[model samples]
Target: MTRTTLALALAAALALAACDRGPANGAPAAAPTAGAPQAQAGQDAAAELDALYAEFWEESLRLNPLSATYIGDSRYNDQLPDTFSAEFRQRQLDFAQRWLERVRGYDVEQLEGQARLSYEIFVSSLEEQIEGERFPGWQQPLNQFYSFPSSFAMLGSGTGAQPFRTVADYDNWLARASNIPTLFDSAMANMREGMANGVVQPRVLVEKTLPQLDGLIKDDPEQTLFWRPIAEMPEDFPEAERDRLTEAYRSLIADTLMPAYRALRRFTAEEYLPAARDSHGLDALPDGEAWYAFNVRRITTTDLTPAQIHDIGLAEVERIHGEMRQVMQEVGFEGDLQAFFEYMTTDPAFTYESEEALLADYRAFEATVDARVGELFSLTPKAAFEIRPVEAFRAQSAAGGSYMRPSEDGSRPGIFYVNTYDLPTRKTWDRDALYLHEAIPGHHFQIALQQELEGIPTFRRFGGQTAYIEGWGLYAESLGRELGVYADPYTYFGRLQAELWRAIRLVVDTGLHSKGWIREQVIQYMKDNSATSDTEAVSETERYMAIPGQALAYKVGELKIKELRARAEAALGEAFDPRAFHAEVLGDGSLPLDVLEAKIDRWIAAQS
Candidate 1:
């Protein structure tokens, strides 16, 4: 995914609202001399600091209005500013620069605890944004992984970010939805620029976009997902206003939205596809190496090179495969690993009878796991969650399971979308581990609790690091045995399979983007090692292709958390409390892996 895609999604979830400081470019300035004016000012700066941060936050909310909307702040909802325009982008750049200067001038040493973290976060965020200006991300906005079209669909689907309860809610959406045409046009214009600049999406991804767009274009507006608000218009709405709005929506859907979607689809298929690159790597485009490097840093939150990540992936994949072989032996599969994988895939018992059965199975896993979470975790989220199948239009390409964080207002519960597009491929073996990772105490607990935090700055509560968030999710899967669900050998093997897939991602994501491995090679590698079906393997490989470096986060993060847990267990001896240890790791929301490690080390030392 592009930075904007991830940023927009993160913004929508209200996950990362804090400012982030960039790494210092040179030596730190010497500390203010004791009793100097700077030191004296620092001692009395808390009240001023609070005021500065509040101003910083209010300004930030205005700049990224979608973020304001997601947090239940309606002040900027009707203002669909042209974020894609050059003027707006420059304005954002200026905003970051100005804020960095404003915050950096403060006497950080005078600030205490949370205030210090707030200052660090804000400065880092500003620097990261300014540094990112070197990249031409706007030129390549439309990818199959996430684009304005897909994001708009999810919002208008009635079950997503857009609220449909109140008249103002309906109006908010009508205004938001009406801006789709301009965004769509901007996407087309950007893609054209991409074509001219040789920054276009891969041919494979553009082809995927066509079918997705086709799914969104329906003959009857009332039947479409976008038409949801009109159908559910609040009873409190004035009759004249409702009728006018309904007819206006119908005309907009039939005339503007549907045709624009179709036109984009046609343009991509007929015109863009022919010009799209056959090569899967972003490195094929201009400054592609720098671009991919930037993505690696953004997603992994580390300076590790692609080659380094590729090597780490290879090592983990081999290590996980050794464990899988033990599973093969336990099952008495008298064959090679490939044969065992095939057996696992084709076995009738591993298949769900239908999508409902699949969702039911996941829900049942949720209940089973929840009953035992007390054994492993002390902290839990107040927000509840449910299991639902991926919406049909996106199911074919969606992951096995993905979690959408709950709205800050708590009007919408967290949702874990399980892809049931191909039932058989949605194997029974995958259910237990997937549930532990996506629902209940995994993403739901960590993310929801973070949002509900009362004292932290808004940014830290909402902002996240991939290594911490995804790493926590992957680590949650490892809790299956302790939480009482990995009793069956098959289920235990599924847990291993989940880890193995993340490990393989570390390898394949790096290989495809950095090592120049072809798509088929990655698919064949997955098929040889794991029980995933060919169809599932292909879709996953393509997903990694579309969003380079993202897959690395899971394995990289899980390994660090696992490593830390092992250390805590070894050092604390009888004092190690899995519940407390889990709370410490999760209570701070998501942090850089190094920061998490440092905090845990402090905990361990304190206990000692």
Candidate 2:
């Protein structure tokens, strides 16, 4: 799941949530699994693969410092890669090419079970990275859903990954912060290139970014989020040093960061916004169809065509609507499904009394779900998690709830950020399903476990495939009933509504990108089929517009996991265990849907 989502949708609706277990899959409870023979030659091959992975990780960290900071690796805290630069893009291309060749030198067939799996995944990822170079992702760098400026504010706010524990940490951020001007310039240049190539973002999406930039650029440095570190500076620091740092930060914010933000804000408002495409679909641009197709392939990790996915979405929407009808009957609502949807969306009882009540309710879910988590999950992460609100600055566009993967060192607990901005709109009915999807036994459970894995390579541990990750979150939501949730009919309806939203995304995302659907069409689709508020519909549609083929992951991944579970239950009969099946699906970390399917098949065969 990414850091953001539509407020109507669960946060981290598209992120890393895995359910791994078994010694073969790096679970502590399982014995050492060696599917390869004890032949010396085979052992050497496996050892070599491990060595390659280690070296690759080391080099990768050096190249991508932001990734290092993200995982709580402070070694590169001072660095910020110029991610939008042509040089950086070329470097990425070169790294993939070199690694692809280096990895191919080893024979995957000669490797044992886990080693073979790692080798295969690494090879496939590198190949995809190489293949992906054809698409001009660098041209379309900024989206309200995912942008550098907002992320920069989070990093420098002293609350995100940039540790503010020591004096060195302060200095490290200063070094990192100094690069903002360069990054913004790079972005401006890239957007210009995008305009030239007819690859510019839709005008509506560009408009959403203006308010985000406005929030970042404040008149007084002390009033800015960048000043937060100084405000919360460690008391233990020598007064003289603290004083010196405070003055330095004041200058940095006013002189450097402000100008950078203003320059970008001005460019965006004056030039880029006007140049942005009026058309909504990716099909409007040159090679837009192919670009979207590549994205669909990367996102779903499947070769299913757009038409196939669109058809799948339509079927799923119909099915979920039928389930919603069941909920309507259970709730004894006098109206039709649409009327009930309108009632649920508009009802005052469904909303929290205040933001405090909203956050408190979300926090309370931890203990509630904790009591039942063990019934379905045999293993849980050692790294704990906490519930927090989405920062006010971005909350307008933020998802209902999102999960941040824990730091590898366990110092940074996974954060489940619930949006408390639009308090009245943040429905109580959504709380349970949102929690299950983004918190315990969902994003938090799957993503943290994947990071904490011992034997898996860093790529599989830290990197993720969207479909499997999001699918697991969606699948985890289905467990609410068995986990003692969805007990109330309205609550159960919320779960179905959540599922329906995802299915709708499958339709709308494909519709917007490939099937000639406009923004209004997508919004109307949500209003008709689900309990999505107008604000949620608009933002959610914009989110799909911003990132094509991404929203499809939730339903596609969930469907696959559910399909696997059903297959296991039917095949093994009395031998079927939900917990074990979950562990198997998540055990290998995130995989391409086909690879995940193959792995699940292997587990099913073993069970048989």
Alpha-carbon RMSD of each model = 3.6, 5.4
Q: Per-residue lDDT for 89-135 in model 1, tens only? A: 77777767766765665667777656666676567666776787876
What are the Cα lDDT values of the candidates?
A: 0.76, 0.81
CA lDDT of 478 in candidate 1? 91
TM-score against native, each model: 0.93, 0.94
- Compare the candidates by lDDT and give the number of the best one: 2
Off by over 4 Å in 1: 1-17, 20-43, 234-241
Model 1 C-alpha lDDT versus the unseen true structure: 0.76
Q: Write the per-residue lDDT of candidate 2 for residues 43-111, one digit (tens) a residue.
A: 776766676577677777787777777788899999876777888778777777766666666555566
TM-score, cand. 2 vs. native: 0.94
